[model samples]
Target: MSEFDAIVVGAGPAGSSAAIRMANKKLNVLLVERADPPGSKNVSGGILWGNALAEIIPEWEKDIPLERLITHKGTTFLTKDSSISIDFRSTKFLENHSGYSVLRARMDNALANSARKAGAMVVTGVTVDRVAKEEGKVVGVEQDGEIITSDAVILAEGANPRVAIDSGLRKPIGDQDVAIGVKQIIRLPENTINERFNLKGSEGFAGEYVLSYLEGEAEAGGFLYTNKDTISIGAVISSSKLREDGQTHSYDIMESFVQHPHIAPLLEGGKLEEYSAHLVCEGGIDSVPRIYGDGYLIAGDAAGFSFSNGLMIQGMNYAITSGIAAADTVIEAKERGNFSSDSLASYERKLEDSYVLKDLKNFRNIDKVTWSRVTHRAIPKIAENLLYSMYHETGRPKKHLMQMILESSRDSGMSKSQLILESYRMMRRM
Candidate 1:
């Protein structure tokens, strides 16, 4: 008999959730993490959206170390000297509590501990070399020099899925299929944060910006999230765009972002406390690989469950959803006494039935629109010029909105046809 019924790789949200679920069902589970503490190696923009966590721990909000509740969300298009933004604030966000800003190191560690409390044998500081297999069926994981055997293996090893790739469950991700994100934790007094962000108590603001100031071929966006006594700010850029630009470094982009006139004032008195960088999967649904095979299933970034639809980026919720689905699939397989490829395929069906796969599939082409010049350059320039012309009154006659639109489109170097085409693309994709 196998030592454990299932071995979960990685202890981030997905692995921990899966381990917790299976353990709660009274299955023997081993949860492994390469990092000494579960969330030490993880990085994100600091917002966990949706109600997926409640499925794992019903009163998670009461227990998790959340930074702030996200009551406002904004997106801005930026030029060198101006910006156009759409800001939305809702009391309903506070009433229903759909999202929260979180520090990964603290939140993920607590989640892993929850798995332990649910009876999972949590092991940290252990690297899983690859999934151990015999007769082309995954049996467990290989760590150090030993084979820790189990009836099944679940890969939750974040974006750099070494074990999944090595096991031939998926091919190497292409440069176009991924993104690189760099984040900074800036410390400010709680009162200072509340004042600067116009927030009260634990209410927070989350903003994403379309970056148009980069000096190369790079396509990227910047984000800022309000935390308890700190701010989480970062940029996520297309990996292929970064390579093609060759001249821009990720740090340089970050420096430029922080110093922007519109951004600088909000963080004037903050001190940099931490900096981290990591790879993020942003290829939408097309880049996702087969999630399940014989006696094995992949969850979280390992299965490319992340989604970015230009306006917002979502991954954590999808990670939790996929994790729960993977565990449920295992539970069903166990009842049937079968850990075969066909049996594990139910995981995919479960995802399809949930918002995880449905949202990804519906917005599959959004990444293309986000990476287009219309989003990064043309739109920002047009908005800046139009708004500046309208508000920056001269003694001369003021033009009507339609005439201003025409002039702005021409000034932005986009013809009528190109503008119409781009608008169509956005409509179709979004």
Candidate 2:
């Protein structure tokens, strides 16, 4: 019989952000989390980019406990025996409010604590079984047969959006629109990490790899990031594609990535400390669900708000921004004493006006390009072969770059015209 102004489900970035904003407005807000602690069940590759942190918590660099700030970025394409890498570094990224690398367990715990300090009531170790509805209007949430009434509910339940789907607010997401990401934290000496990635002081390096050597068999990509005294490494594969493959599991894909000649040396003496797996909403704008319902709103992965447009994987920023927008809508509803779908519809408008929806809408075709067999299998191989031919030195005669390109294209089984068209499409979409 407990009553509150609003109930926010899941204490990840989105939920905490919403709760913090609500509490700051003197609204009675409750943040319900299923984990024993705020981030106990959360796992991420852990990169916070853009100006999201500043918007949520100003002076965050000085006030928050973070692993490191990122100043080095690298992307590598791997063949069985060779690798090609591109790296970039900037002094601008070393400033006080720059991007950061963090462990979600620690970071989310801090975010939850901030919400509590802002006057939001946070309850952990409880799962919201369902949204309580009256005459098709969400009035509260049910947990362990107990009913807690609230004026509105915000669903930020991460990738597994059971509550949102169950509430009839969103259609069940298909596996084709999702990805399974498996990651591990491996302990390495701080000196070793610095030397391995060429980092100075607390600056960190992040590397993304596409395993072209695996050829037609590799249906996914890999990533490596340098943490304080540990390295984060992982692979993400289309869930439906992975299931279709049948013989490979996340562990196998991870092993293949680590054993790649270009990647093995950096992981030579590292000790594995943790392993985790989670689903990523990679559906782009096409997969985003309806934002508002009779008395509920969806944010974060629950609403398919993730964007993976090749160069970057962004979800946390989108989640945080959407959560703030949803909170603003709830605040407005409170003032008007109207929690109808019409009033909550403002959340959708805010999202559409912001970069969250704009970026996703702009790159709507990216998901299709990424999931294409040609991009996932053929393009990388062609690039690797082209690079190999261009770099290899022969005593007798050398082929021109154009000749190497033709040969590599022939080897990839695609005609020059097809390659040109696909490349053009990808460039436009990206």
Candidate 3:
């Protein structure tokens, strides 16, 4: 911990990717993680999006721990006793696949190992206490009682960032800026999961739900992902909503969701294997802070690199892309013998040209649209009622479709005008 070309704090996807990229360029990069083995402290709902990894490392499959390749996908809207979903099941969709279901414990270790193999010195059980700076420029990291000098520092320390915040690289995240993800991994036989999800071999389905299973006091949603022999099911809620409710824990909501009519049958015979929780960035583009500064760059969740538009939740993709951009900027700075903010400003340009920032920028209003009551309450109820009217059979007089729709809307306690307005709002923003 004395001197290096760069210091990367936290060995999650962002940190490890950044380290690997720089080290591959022959830079002496030192990557440190407080978790003894890395990824031990991380939790995810699986389903990593994008194929940026293949571009970063042509042979990365050998370095990533994959649980299943996604073959079926859907998003469901759920009310207290009913649900409606839009699904796509195909073998041809991204056949080679850009996404995968993974467990962080295995994935992170493999990524960290890849960085080490790329010639970066990797250390675990090491906490970076502060960014050591002099004359208004970051020059190293402080760990324990010593300073490790470096030309620049990269912070990819997940949602709750310490060094990034303490070093003045970014502002402390607020309750509204984050969502708490509580998840449980349930174990079932591989064959059983395949049978239940209608999959063959290692193919699996991933689903996210705008659940009304829990009390409506706090707005939240749920996700379920199929691993090889286990299923990851959980819910994510705004932290401010959780605190304002102050009546139930996220785990309790997860419990109720598991016991719900639609979800219960899916996990009928499974053993609970893991229960975990973590913070997720949900504030969209506006919530993102300045990503680059003199001698410092922030990547991953620490930089608010996450997006959940109630359909697809993307984080890892942004993390990897931003990590690569950071490494590219640092490599250029080292080459130019200038580690100033001006030199690293290229990172922003790199991201602007990449899908990472473009997607975030395009969906900047997603938080407003997806977090609306339309997603969780009114829309689901409306859809459920309409479907019930269409499918329910009885020996009665047949009614016109328009009349049936009106009756369904009234039964769901929504005026036709309200439904039209909500639909229009969603269309306008999303």
Candidate 4:
């Protein structure tokens, strides 16, 4: 017999949620983490979108460590010296509580504690070398030359997915499927944050910027989120783009972002509190690996359950939902006394029925839409030039909308035909 009914690797949203659900169902569970504290290794800033957490812990908002509730959102098309933004603020977002700003360390630590309270054996500061297999089926995990046996194993090892790749559970993630995310926590006064961002009470703001201003052939985007007493600013750049440009690095892009005239004032009085960098998935559905097999399953970033649709980036909620679905599958499998691949295949069905896979499949081509030169460069420049023409004061008569648009399109270095074709493609894909 196995020692534990299920073993969950990593302690982020996915692993911790899996452990909690399994433990609550009275299945002996072991949740292992490489970092001493559950989320200590994670990059500091992110948004937890959706209300998936309420499914597992109904009163989570009353206790979970969230920085602030997002009540405002903005998206900017940015050039080197100009920008045009669409900003919206709604009380509905706060009342319904759709999203919150989170620091992973506090959030993950709280989740691990919840798992412990749910009666799972939570272990930290230990690295799982690989899943222990017998007869081509995973039976447990090996760590420090020792074997810990389990009836099933759930891999929630985040974006790196070393165990999944090493164990032949999935192919190695290619550069096209990955991006580098770098973030920093800048400490600011609470009232100052409130005043600068026009926030009230627990209301927070999230803004995304297209980083067309970066030098070289780099494709990247920037984000700035308002926390209670700090600001979270970061950029996600294509790994392959970074490799092509010998001069520009992720940090250099970050430096340029924070110093931008539009972004600098909000962070003027802030002091740097923390900095972190990590790998993120950008490949949508095509990059996802085999998620379930005999006596084993994968969830969260390990299974590539992340999505970006140019306007919004969502992962944590998908992670939470995927984690819960993984646990539920194991519960059903346990009832039938089967842990075979055929039994665990229910995991995929659950994801398909849920928004996790449905949304991914629906927007699978978003990567092509957002990563294209037209979306990142030509569009932003055209927007800036057209807006500049409209707003700039001159003694001469102002040009009409069509004239300005034609001039902007000509200056953008793309033909009208190319622009129209790309716009059609974007409309169809998005």
lDDT of 3 by residue, 126-233 (tens): 989888998988888998769889999998998888788887778888987888888999999999999999999989889988875556468788899999999999
TM-score-wise, the better of 1 and 3 is 1
Quote the positional error of residue 411 for candidate 2 in Å. 0.8
User: Which portions of model 1 show Cα errors greater than 4 Å?
Assistant: 309-311
Model 4, runs deviating above 4 Å: 309-311
lDDT of 1 by residue, 135-167 (tens): 999999997769999988999998889999987
- Which pairs clash in model 4? none
Deviation (Å) of 246 in candidate 2: 2.8
Per-residue error at 83 for model 2, in Å?
A: 1.5
Q: For residues 1-430, could you state the per-residue lDDT of candidate 2 as single tens digits?
A: 3389999999998999999899999999999999878898998887876677566688777665677788998877666776778888988776654567878888889889989999999999988988998898999998877889999999999988888877677888897568888899999999999998888889998777765555334367777888899998888777776777777777788888887777889998999999999887888888888888877899988888888643457788888899999999999999999999999998999999999999888888886676665666567678878887777776758877788877887867677788788878878877
> How accurate locally is residue 356 in candidate 4, as Cα lDDT from 0 to 100?
91
**lDDT (Cα, 0-100) at 30 in candidate 4:** 98
Candidate 4 C-alpha lDDT tens digits along 114-202: 99999999999999999999999999999977999998999999989998898899999988778888899999999999999999988
lDDT of 4 at 275: 89
- Least well predicted 10-residue stretch by lDDT in candidate 3: 407-416
Question: lDDT of all predictions, in order shown?
Answer: 0.89, 0.83, 0.85, 0.89
Q: Candidate 3, residue 103: CA error in Å?
A: 0.5
